[model samples]
Structure formats: C-alpha cells, structure tokens
Target: MSAPTATAPVGQTDTDASAPRRPRRKLLFIGIVVAVLLAGAASYVLVLGPDAAADEAVPVVEEGAVIEVGTLTTNLAGTPAQYARVGVALVLSADADQSEVTARFPLVKDAAIAEIGRHAAASLQGEEGLEPLRRGLTERIQAVYPDGEVVRIALTELLVQ
Candidate 1:
C-alpha cells in the first residue's frame, strides 16, 4: 500500500503558507502608498507650479549701455526743400571705450545725419521706410567707430516733412 499523506487537523491552517502571505500583503500596501504619493507630487508640479512662476516679469538683457546721440535736422534728398528731424542713440558694446565714444560724439551725430540726408522725404514717412533707415544708420555709425564698438543704433524719433 502507498504511504498516507500528512494533513492538518480540522479548524487549523498551515503556518508556512499563512506566514508568507502576511509579508506579501504588507509589501502590496506599501507599494500602493508609494504610487499614490508619486501621483500627488506629479499633479502638484504640473498644475500649480507654473502659476507660482508667472507672477514675475522677465527682464530684457541688452548687450551694453545706450549713449544718446541727440537730434539732427537735415535736408532730405528730394526737391521742394524737404527736411527730416531725427533723434538717435548709440548702444555701445560691452568692451567699448566710453571715453573715446563720448569724445567723438559729434562724429557719431554727423554720420547719422549723413545717412538720413540720403533718404527721400517720402521714403521716411511710414513704418516701412523706418527699417531700412535704421539699418543704414547702424552701418553708417559703425563706420565712424572701429568694428564692434557700436553694437546697435536706436532711432528714438523720426519726422520727415
């Protein structure tokens, strides 16, 4: 005959099987808690983080300081005695010599006037005409100084009549 198998008594459970299940249940609970925490953290970052950051205005960074070139009234190229009144400023590069620029301010103004004098009165009347004028002024002012000394030319005011 075959040997009889071992069996637990009635109303009793196996200790080994039950012991392993307790640790598994605890681990499952801990894993669920960790998942919930991560979800909460992600939601907070996605929803509320940008609003807190939006309160401050971002500042614009310019390459260097601006030197006012004052205003120049010059005769336009067209006939009928047309004239243009232009106010401009020079933005110096970071490494430029301020003293030299200040000493030669008159030459900077002269360069701007010469550029403006080349354009016709009708050409400087509208916004479309202003861009070319600005580019021309920048190039003209750069010619007055060494390369890279003048970073940009800012035209503050322009009136052609």
Candidate 2:
C-alpha cells in the first residue's frame, strides 16, 4: 500500500519490437525518395540537355536588310467582297545586298501581293494562321531572291474588311 512494486503493465511490453526498425524504415523510405528524385533530374538532363530552354530560342541574323512591300489591298476568296489591306516588311538574308534588294523591289512586292491574295478572309484571323502565311510568303519571295532568300516576312499592318 505504501509503494507499488516494479512490474510490467497488463497490456504493455518492457521492450518494443518495432522501435529500432521504425526509424530504419523511415530512413530507407527517405533514401529511396532521394534516389528517385536524383534519377529523375539525371534523366531530364540527359533527355533535354543542360540548357533546354536556351535551345528553343530563334537565332537572330545580323546585318539583315528589310524591304517594305507597302500596303497591299486585295479581296479575299469568298462570295462577298472582303478586302484586306496588309503592310508587309520582308527581312532578307544577312548576306543580301541592300542595293540588289532595292533593285528587285518589283519582284518582291509582286510575290508578296500574290501570297497575300492566296489566303481566304477567315484563314488569316488568329495566331495559327501567321505561321503558314509567313512560310508561304517566304517561299514566294525566296523564289525570285534565291541567292539572298527572305529570312522573315513581318506584317507591319493588317486590316480585313
């Protein structure tokens, strides 16, 4: 009655069987997670290379000549008369001679006008249309300026009515 004797509780054990193994299991799980993370990072580097985002940038051509096609007024391909007035500027190759480009303005303008006329009014509405239009314009302009190809065709102004 004065003091309780040293004895184990009814449902409790003196030593826990899983006490040491719990910490070890936690550590093993942590190690496995770290290993997986490291593997993922390694695979990403291997697949995409070190500078993944850097690889996606477009290259700028230095000393590029620009030729203005002026404002092109044309009717779109439809039953109703829908016209488009687009001001285009052609960025010629870096190797292009400014003098030659000036001389070949007629050819360049003609090609660009023809290219613009090829598209329907609805097809040139969104961002999706810009790429195809650019590609087509480049192809058209490059035909005449084969030596100094058109690197880029920029739409300085666009209007459809």
Candidate 3:
C-alpha cells in the first residue's frame, strides 16, 4: 500500500483548507474599511469643507424706520374722471428725525396727493404702475422736505374706480 495520509479531526478542516478563507475574510474587511474612509472623506469635502463659509455669507441689513401717512383720495389725470384712494407710509433714513417728520405731516400728505393725481387710472393698474407711483411720491416728498429724510414710499392701500 502507499504511504498513509494525514487526516483532520472529525469536526474540523485541515489548516491548508482554511488558509484561503482567512485571506478572503481579511480582504473583505479591508474593502469595508476603505469604503468607509472614502465616504467620510467625500462627505467632508462636499458639505463641511472650506467653501462652506463663503457660501454662507449672507449680510443682514436693518430696515429703516417707517411713518404712516394716512389714506387720501384724488382724481386721476385721465379722462372720464377716475379717482384713486391710496394709503401712504414713509420709510425714513437711519439718521432722520422722527419729530421733524411728524411735524411736517401735512406737507408730506399734500405731496402724496399731488403725485397720485399725476398718474392716470389706467397707469395705476398693477405692480408696473405702483412702483413708479412710489418713486414719484418719494421724489415729491423729498422736494418738500429737502432733508433726504424719506428713503422710500410704501403704499399700504390702493383702490381705483
């Protein structure tokens, strides 16, 4: 008979049989570790990276003070005798004096009415109309005050008929 061969224990495989499995398990473990590391690096570079600060640079601007100038009704410039009822408010610059603006309320109201009367009923139809109206009112009020106190004009209410 040939030389007797070596055999593993009844419940276990020989070392040579398990050697290949050890290397495969090691390779799988290494692959998982590499994948985890790559994912972490990608996340940090995309989300929490250096460019984040520049992307987050949103400036905060303070809104100036506002003064309400009550509503006024005036006849529009167009034919057929149209009238517009408008409510006005003034946004004052940061250094403007509240008491001064309050004292000159009548002049402000008059200028607002005059400006409204310059625009036709059709001109005051939509946002296209209202923006110019605001700018004109601001200019007139500025002319009366001449102090640059009024920074913007807001139309709180508007109705044409």
Instruction: Give the best candidate by lDDT.
Output: 3
Best by TM-score: 2
Q: Output the TM-score of candidate 3.
A: 0.59
What tens-digit string does per-residue lDDT give for candidate 1 at 1-161?
Answer: 99997776786677753565778899999999999999998898887785655645653334688888898999999795899889998898877888888888888888887899899988886779999999999998888887577888898888778
**lDDT, each prediction:** 0.84, 0.80, 0.86
Clashing residue pairs found in predicted model 3? none
- Where model 1 places Cα greater than 4 Å from the true spot, the runs are 1-62
Model 3 off-target regions past 4 Å? 1-63
lDDT of the structure predicted as candidate 1: 0.84
TM-score of each: 0.59, 0.60, 0.59
Q: Is 2 or 3 the stronger prediction by TM-score?
A: 2
lDDT of 3 by residue, 1-161 (tens): 89999888787778755666777899999999999999998998887896777767954334479989899999989874799999998888888889998899999888888899999999988899889998899889888778677777889999999
Q: Answer with 1 or 2, whichever has the higher TM-score.
A: 2
